[model samples]
Target: MEIVNSAKEIQEYLQNTRRELHENPEISNKESKTSEIILRELEKFGNFNIRKNVNGNGIIAELIGAKEGKTIALRADMDALQIEEETGVSFESKNKGVMHACGHDNHMTMVLGAAYLLSKRKDELSGKVRFIFQPAEELSPNGGAKGMIKEGALDGVDAIFSMHVWPDLPLGKVGIKEGPLMAASDHFTVTIKGKPSHAAKPNEGIDALVTGAQYVTAVQTIVSRN
Candidate 1:
């Protein structure tokens, strides 16, 4: 009950921070401004031993508890997608051609919210809490997590927890399971070439657009059909 009440007290803080982040979204590998804001907020929290610019705009913040125990980590992604905002919200993305479409703004705010509450309740804790703010999550095969780990983000961590916002879930509800909650992602690139045709010509040249669309439709069903 105490923790719940404390979290409620910071509800406004969480919302405002989330909105601030959403308004100025940055794409993968370009989260400098995002890292600055996170650093500022963590500094205001005042108990974390923060390491900035870890593996390109990543942040690792550690908070020691009152007693000696294990270390735990909480992670949040810090990259936005290359998308334009059409949500029409008052605090929609201000950076053109980039948007927090993946809810990373929310994820960062949630981690900061946890940091805020934990900062105030350090006396009750027995272990250390590490907060990891990683960038370039949208870039696969070479995401920021690899660099963060190389920078010792998990040097002394016993366990780590991270979560994402799911639009499929009901409002104010959280879903969790024992095993993995998200599926692995794979990236691929395909290029199709076609001869150029005059605008007035009906069928003189091959239609690469149609070929690409057909390929996309066929590829989309690979997993389901297999």
Candidate 2:
């Protein structure tokens, strides 16, 4: 696919879309409204095969080119974190205690922007492009990616692409790498089996809280030291 090269020209569209998403953020597994908004906006392009409700509120939109080539996929997550809006901005989250604090709003806006640009030039492209709006990314141990993959989200796709917002980075700056830039994240539970002890007891029983803290501190050594 060729670069659109007019990202700056579409600045206002992107900002308004992102602000709308940020104001009405939805948490994991509850992105029905978000999914609706994405579908509604994607329909404006009027050139794609749109699939909705893929493994619970996931959306897949495809733009097939006139020529024959490989199919590439672009993905975006549509979930917000559990946080209250304290910034007092006008477009702050309407849903109390739920906000797009992790910048998923920007992620969705970017992918939608890409979809718009690609659809505009679908006649000149040489391959297919898939746009995925995934839900439940904030939940671990059973994220929405697993569900989408199980339902064949990546099937028949030659390559995939995704984007994320970095901390305090300049506009249009991109980072590329061959190897994985992030470590694998998974959920873990540590249940220390210790007897209940009194607060002032010197050596009555084991202290689970102190033991957990020590375990955490010990684990930090792996990252802090060589």
Candidate with maximal TM-score = 2
> Can you write out model 1's per-residue Cα lDDT over 67-177, one digit (the tens) per residue?
999999999999999999999999999899999999999999999999999999898889999999999998887899999999999998999999899999999899999
Question: Model 2: how far is 173 from its true place, Å?
Answer: 1.5
lDDT of 1 at 165: 98
User: Which clashing pairs does model 1 show?
Assistant: none
Off by over 4 Å in 2: 1-5, 196-204
Candidate 1 TM-score, true structure as reference: 0.87
Q: Distance (Å) between predicted and true CA of 126, model 1?
A: 0.7
Candidate 2: tens digits of C-alpha lDDT, residues 26-81? 99999998998899999988899998999899999999999999999999999999
Model 2 local distance difference test score: 0.90
* Per-model lDDT: 0.94, 0.90
Worst 10 residues of 2 by lDDT: 1-10
Residue 30 in model 2: lDDT: 95
